[model samples]
Target chain A: MAVEILKENYAGKVLSMTIGVGDRAVTVGGATALPFHSFEGEVGNRPLIAYEVLDTVPEDPPASLQEELESVWDDPVKWAKYCQDEQGARAIALRLVSTDPDGQDASPESAAETVKKVLDAIDIPLVILGCFKEAKDGPVLKAAADAARGCNCLIGKAQEENYKTIAAAATANGHKLIAFSNLDFNLAKQINILLSQADFDINNIVTDPTASALGYGLEYTYSVIERIRAAGLMQNDAMMQPPMFLDLSSVVWKVKEVKASEEDLPEWGDRTERAVHWEAATATSLLMAGAEIMVMTSPRAIQTVEKTIDQLMA
Target chain B: MLLIGERINVITKAQRAAMEARDPKPIQEIAKAQVEAGATMLDINIGPAEDDGPQLMDWIVKTVQEVVQVPLCLDTTNLDAIRAGLKAHNNEWGKPMINSTSGETVRLNTFMPVAAEFQCDIIGLCLSGSGLPADANERCAIAVDIMGKAAEVGLPIENIHLDPLVLMLNGNQEQAMHCINAVEMFQTLNDPPMKTVVGLSNIANTAPMEMKGILTAVFYKMLVDAGLSGAIIDTLEKDFMEVVRTGDPASVYPAEHVEKTMKVMRGEIMYAHSFLEV
Candidate 1:
């Protein structure tokens, strides 16, 4: 008897969306089978990793995240340029953290200026993330989206509360919108449907179905991502077909394993290595769960993630 | 699951009486009830009681469509009756389906073009006349041939769903495993998997009444793992439909998800707040 491999012929493929313009532009999704099930179908693009940069000065972004880019930490443009030019970043995720109503409370105009400087300095793709505060997200994200016009960037995180204004901005600027739903499958689908109702085509969309840190309820996040992928591939669902965007570092860095100090807890191992491993492990787990793009902060973690991808995809 | 509810046929006592009287109420009630019970398609089979079978099939098709918005699966052995149902079909929902054809020479020659000409989907029974194949490999070959013939008539292979006939597992235990293998092999016939189904109630035809539901549901779950995408079953069986809904965990989840989903399957986790509520 011959042993046959269990391979699926997925009815639907993930929507392949192109980010950035010119030679360095990246295209993600287009797997007619499950992730890395190469015997059955083709995986069009490898997962993309974008180094995260903040518009506000980094008051504190974990000590492990700090040392990786100590030289470029002072300036957002320097940080974005350094990640693109020096680190060979295929994409840059510029988070407008200062525009939050409760944080630094910077005006939308200043955030847009930061966006313009980074857009002018980098040739790679950009994913502009809003501060996610309900009161100020509409104005700030609109300014950032307007600033990155014609760049073919991914502008997003349209939550239920502020999706209307963000959807308008993303469509008007001709960029993909990232709809965020808090770890619930129906809400993720509902928000995408909601975005489509606002006249944004469902194809020009990415989804963040709420990232959970590796140790803290990671299984729930894993299951949700799997459900999304299955609905798209096996079930031929359009609303669930967008490439998953795992915003890992924001949650991973704040977790116990990634932030606990070596001196504070010696048996937990080296603080820097542990944090890098935490980010890489969280990313790899989600990639297997069907993430197409991930936003991460540590260079060492990105290296490990690339290595893991190579090993699995090889 | 593309559940074609099998309870509307004149083979049942109430259905026969209603068809004999030319009354539309019973047919209409079954149509509305099946649709409400989560059936995507209803199979209309007008039995031999009526000499005006074609006209009655047309009436049944029209009556069902009036009550429900789902596509109808015209279920009859006679080509003319199938045509009448197809003629009366008002595709307010989508293209309707033909219950089936087989790799038998007469079937492939007659039914393939009817499906293509009408632009309707069909079920391809994986049989070539003598009987259900003794093994999975032979059944797969016949399914492939049926698909090829359907394609020759300009019917895209996807429009042809192959049903590797579900055999009675009471005395023929080996046939159960063969059906599972055939279902899995049907997927390899196309790049995106040719649709496949099991005539679910046929598996328990010889079993006792209480055992029928349990046996069919277990077999249905197994067939789903083997890539069965549709079924011809009693939609009134709420527990069976639930099995169909929750079938095939491997295709839908990671290992960790399977662990949690298994608990959901076993009723250990009732209010699972995840979007996995199929």
Candidate 2:
């Protein structure tokens, strides 16, 4: 008997959407087959990388990130500029952490100022993330969205509780919206259905099922993304076809394996190298599991993942 | 799962009347509603329309395609009617599917060439001219014949969908298991594995009216888990549609209903008049 290769014929393709404006715009998520299964169908665009730039300075930053970004920590514009210029970042994710009600409680007006300054400093695309506080995010993201209007930026994280105002702001300003959900396929799909019901163009939406670090429930996140992608490709589900977004930096940096000191655990290897490897491993695993847009910190980790993407795309 | 809506058939009173009157409102309304409710394809069954089958199929195909942008499955015993529907199809969304061809030599010889020429999908019924098969192995035997014909005509394996006919649960209980097993068997019969579809409601056809919904929904979950690809089902049933959308039948149906349905499926208990009560 002759050995024959079995290939799956997919019925659907992931909808590709472009963010940013002019020649610097980035398009993602148009895979007719599974992620990197290029022999089966067209894998549209390469997975994109966006460096995380925080609005507020952290009290206890990792040694590797602090060493690299210490000079630009206090200034959001300089931080974004350094990531864009020196780090060779393709895009920047401006996280409005100071707007958290439990933290600095920075007003929406101040968040808007930072957004405007970052937009002026970077030539690449921008992704405006919220403080993760449902109530505060509505106003802060709206202000930030207004400040970056017509920039074709990606603004997000419209959750189940506060999608109305954020979706409105993204729609009104001609920017794309990120629909965030917990680590469940149903919840992720429900958010997209809700946004569609609200008259938001389904093509302009990106799915963000919340991410977890490598050791901290990464498998659950991986399964959710895999299910979402299968629903889009195998089932031809219209609502689940949008590209997926993952915030690897926020979760990867907080894990114990990534932040532990070498003196505390001498057998675990060097602190800086271990942290970078942790971030890179989490990112590459999810990328294979089907992640199109990833927000990551640690310039070295970003570079490592970028190299891995090139190898996979090749 | 490719959810093919089963609402636009001539068996329904409104649909039959609309087809008789040549009215497009009632038919188009159901087509649009099914698409809105997450039906990727609609089955347009015009039952043995020996006389005006061709014209009726053409009109309905054009009518439905005008309003929505999903594929249509032209279902009838009339070959000319199937051809007319195919001719009238716009192909803006996708090619029209012929529902379907069976292992019977005449039907297979006639339709496989058309399916190959159009390069659209066609459902392969896993039965012979003698009637429905007795077991999964018998169904596979017939499927081999169908695949041979499809190959002779150069039909792409991906475009071929094998349907292991769903039997009623009230009496032919063992055949239900065979149907599910046949679906699993059809998947491995080809290199680029063949797709599978089922008339999902047939399993619950003779059940109590009140028990039909749970019966079909639970059976749908079983077929999906067994690797069945497409299902012709009532897409408007919210609970059943929930299972279709989320693929979590355990969450949508009641716990006892799911367990009872499983018992019947496994042949642990006979399907009876008081099946749900048991």
Candidate 3:
């Protein structure tokens, strides 16, 4: 049977770019189709997964993950290098966790230094993330954006309230911006619209539909991503068409299933195995739902996710 | 243009009987045949048949998708049935079409989001609370309104198919003409011409035998001229086949392929040429 190719030809195009540089650089591209369904439609590039590095030590990480990152977690640059050199990470996502208000209250200068250190150590595309807290992230991300100037890195987690400063910084520093929004598809679209209306070229924007862990509203995440992709293709909704980025590891790690001890959930089986599976499952699902780039942790879990993606693309 | 084969409706006795018996073989056969007949989609409707509409729609959609690569158009007024069909087939390409809706604000309010969520195309009928428009002007007005509403919800106009509600010859001889005129009007109004279609046999319903043939030909001719892309017509009819052949000026048959297929269909083409060489 001759299949009718459903090609989406639209007025606006989604911006695509690899966040990091050099050997670890992961190429991100956009096709107006669902993930890995080229025969049915068009998907220009396979989803890329980036391993995450924390600027400050995590309060409590699963034993399985701790075992992997124990040696280098103290230094953000070393952690970034470990992800790229040893774990074969396609990109490095440096989370400025120290800037969190309740955390170390690390100054903007410190965050800038961390950004410089990671950039110097790894040449792959870099995604410098702001601390989740809006007030603290404003200054920290500004400093980090300046330090990473002209490296062509992508910096983000720019929310509705703090987008002005972050977008200006990104515009000035020659970096891509990640427009973060709540779980709602419309809100994600609105944020993109807001940015573009402010003269921020949407082609440089990647949307982050705030991720939820496996078994924790993951279906909602899947639906949101799927909706965004459909809007881009079938509806040709310009504002919602940007390549989506999923913060896969942070969401997966924070879930109880990943952190719960063997005694806490006996039926869940081994904690480490379950935790890795949780991350893998969550990341895989997001990829299927049209996540172009993912920021993840756990080298073994990354391996599993990459394998799943290989099979899906195959 | 997406062809949603509207053959599974329980409005027909045979279809109702098939649904009542919980027998999906006939519906599945219809769906498969439509797909083979160049339909990129099949509309499954088991509306209020005492049988499980949702379950039947799901089964047929899945069964059809398993055999045919084309998508299914879930045609039912029942929301549950539509949801069921969506759940049963989860593939991206197999996305279902929510068969129809009128432009009434209340109806659009409910239907638009579902269409968006399911990522399906919708068929918009040109009618409002004033009922089916009596003339082409009113019909075109309703159609434009529906198109605007669809656009407002971010539905690309190409994804919307406008049905101008063809009327039977027995009721009004001019109904077909009105529908054709509306199609032309809609074509001009739409940015990228929206797909226009109708039930081809509707114009002939209860009409005199001679009148049916003449009206069908006239209706089809007007539709063709007005840029009607597709319709739910009887594929078995010689007249319909002729219309399909001449529908578009650009659809010239590939002579070799046509001859081969026609010969095979007639059992004249053989596969044993080498073996029979003496």
Candidate 4:
């Protein structure tokens, strides 16, 4: 007897979304099937990985990053250009960590100026992420969104505590918005619903279920992404249909495995490769789980994920 | 979307035997399994238990409730069975719902009053003494009558879920679009909005076994897009559940299969044994 191969027939599709303008504008999502199940349906575009660029040098920069691009780490414009021109990054995610009141406490005007500088240096799409301090992000993102207006950049990370100002800013500036929820399917859906209810165009909205690095609650984040994707495609839920965005760098860099030196744990092999693998592994796993776009650190890790995505798409 | 598990109906041989023997084990096991498989409600169907409906209905209601606490929909042509089920129902989950009443005057009169007295949700089939309405407008006409009659009986219009009635696609292909249109019409019927549901699997009846899954899932997407509120479906099918939960069939199913299903549903191509094979 011949054994039959069973296949799933999904009724819904993830919204294929495009960010930026002109030739460098990248489109993600629009999956007709689960990630890389192209034998059954259309998988539209390959996942886009954006290199993470910080507005200010981190207090604890990863050694791998320090060894590679120590020259441009302090300058956002040089850093973005290095990623775009040298590393061949598909997109750039500029984290305005300096704007947090608890951190460098840079003013919104300065953040906007930095955004203009970065936009001028790179032709690829830019994703502007705010210092997640709810109270501070509104004004900072509002200024940044206004500065990037008509560039069609993706302005993010509006959470429940402070979505109104950020969503309004993104809408007013004609930029895409990323609605962030704390690793729960219902919360993710609710934020998108709230955004759409406020007259923000549903198509331009991207969902962020919040990413966690490998071995640190990544499974929970993975499940939420799968559920969000399934709800968008299988349940045809309009609120959950937006392509997903995962921020992997922030969580990946903080974990002990990425930070521990080779001297401290000689059995774990080289510190630099170990850290790069940690970031690459996390990104690869989430790609399988339906992350349409991701923000990643470690140039080596981004290259590994890019090659993996090419093979998977093939 | 509301999913009422269709597995417990007595038309199936195993369930009919279980209901006849008054054995609660098989029936309760199925009930527990369906709830675990993601059914928010279950249809307890006794197919015209003309001889002992009242006793069986009461027994089954109490029996199924012992295992699962989800809401139940009492399904039968026997009027006494519906009353018996309600009388024995435990509302820890929710009040029991009537499986159906039609636009036929006698059925509307008999069940609407019972539905109102017990304050239960009811499925109002858009059908009459003459049989299923020919098109969406005719179905809407029957729906209006059913709504008006429910009002006259003091039943809340909100409690009535209008079913536009799905027909087998092989014989009645055009009725599929009419049913979808009717669901869209039913959604705009009232201010707070009336609910609409369908027997989702009915559209695939008599289709090849291989084709049933794709047909049901694709049509389900259409119904959901039309603003359907619920469906009585084979909730045990994992892919079907995925379709119901995600509401997108185009992404999971093969491109050719989805397109073929669409062509058949739209009546662009006649349904045949080779429809999917081609």
Interface RMSD score of each model: 13.7, 16.2, 29.2, 17.8
Worst ten in a row by lDDT for model 4 chain A: A231-240
- Interface C-alpha RMSD, model 4: 17.8
TM-score of each: 0.55, 0.57, 0.53, 0.55
Across residues A2-45, which tens digit of lDDT does each residue of candidate 1 receive? Answer: 99988777888899999999999999988887888888898758
Candidate 2 lDDT tens digits, A22-105: 888999988999999998999889989899999989768988788778999898898999998898888999999999999899
DockQ for every model, please: 0.02, 0.02, 0.01, 0.02
Best by TM-score: 2
TM-score of chain A of each: 0.97, 0.98, 0.94, 0.98
Model 4 earns a TM-score of 0.55
Question: Between which residue pairs do clashes occur in model 1?
Answer: none
For this target, which candidate reaches the highest lDDT against the unseen true structure?
Answer: 2
Share of reference contacts found in each model: 0.00, 0.00, 0.00, 0.00
Candidate 2 error regions (>4 Å):
B1-278
Chain B, candidate 4: TM? 0.97
lDDT tens string, model 4, A116-199?
A: 999988889999999998999999999999999988899878998899999999988989999998886756866776777688
On lDDT, the stronger of 1 and 4 is 4
C-alpha lDDT of all candidate models, in order = 0.82, 0.89, 0.74, 0.88
